[model samples]
Target: MSGENGNEEESRGLKSLRQLIRILSVKSGIDEAMADDLFDFLLTVDPEKGISDEEVEQIKGYKQADVRKVFRIFYDLRIASYRRGKHPDTGATRYYWYLDSRDADLALLRRKLQVLEKLKMRLKYEKENEFYVCPKDGARYTFDYAYEYQFTCPKCGTMLVPDDNSKYVKVLEDRISRLEEEIKKDERRVFGR
Candidate 1:
């Protein structure tokens, strides 16, 4: 039973890692296919040594430039690392890349904090602001902006109506609560706090 619980925790950690990678990759606007490729490659390799340029080039049908671009996307996310070294056989210069797991945990922690702060600010705004929505286009605007448009939709000329965003407030509140809990747990694990 204890071993099974350990496995479950390990699985949860892995799922969180994958989720973090997916979020970071999508937020970077990297193509989903290319991001999957990079993730798969890293999963198959020993992270300490990473994979060489030649190995990365083995990704079928991808242009060298495209592969490099994928690498750059990973590098930009800070979850991946790039380094150069001498080939043991040929003594030629070679480049390698790999996932930075420890750094990734820290980055995810920072992202959770940023998201928590942003959500709190947005929730406050949602609570404080009077919102108007265009009946035709579903476009939303603040009270001041809507009043400037004379309570009319500029795009479609439909009347702007008061929108009750109570559901959105609930959603934001729930998200904020869940994220705060997750961050607290992750902090305890990652920072030993």
Candidate 2:
């Protein structure tokens, strides 16, 4: 039924949002549990009347400082926004936070682009460089560095051998290809292009 389809779509959106929050948490060095809690709370907020961080702390039982930290990360990632307002009871300034769906999509796209660029750079380096590894210590070095050191392991005094990086190169290429396909699909979905 149409209702089932609607529910499916809603769940998919939530799943994507959760994944984005997890990524942001790792990148910002925040606790994933706290970020998930904050994200779930934000989902219940009315966009027109956003909820303040203090309210979130009171309702969610999270430390005010921790809530603020997560909110700051969300803001920095462009997944959330806040508006300044005065508390109705205290007549003091407060910030009410809410998620902007469009901004979240844009942020996701930007992140994907960044990852794609980094992967491409890594693939290029892997393809261009010849690597050497110490047979005993398992330490890896570039061809130039190994040659400079007389193709020996400094720590163990073991002769260095050529490292076969074809597998690694193939893995990078596959990842880059998959990520490129995903980005193209996301662009079509988000931008209708």
**Candidate 2 has what TM-score?**
0.54
Candidate 2 residue-wise lDDT, 95-147, digit = tens: 99987667555545565666677777788888999999998889999999999
Taking the tens digit of each residue's C-alpha lDDT, what string does model 1 give over 12-98? Answer: 645565666667667767566666766656655555687776667775556666567767766765767868888889999887887
Clashing pairs in 2: none
Sequence-dependent TM-score of model 1: 0.52
Worst 10 residues of 1 by lDDT: 1-10
* Residue 138 in model 2: lDDT: 91
Please provide TM-scores, in order, for all candidate models, with all chains considered together. 0.52, 0.54
- Once fitted onto the true fold, the runs of candidate 1 whose alpha carbons sit more than 4 angstroms away are 1-101
C-alpha RMSD for every candidate:
14.1, 14.6
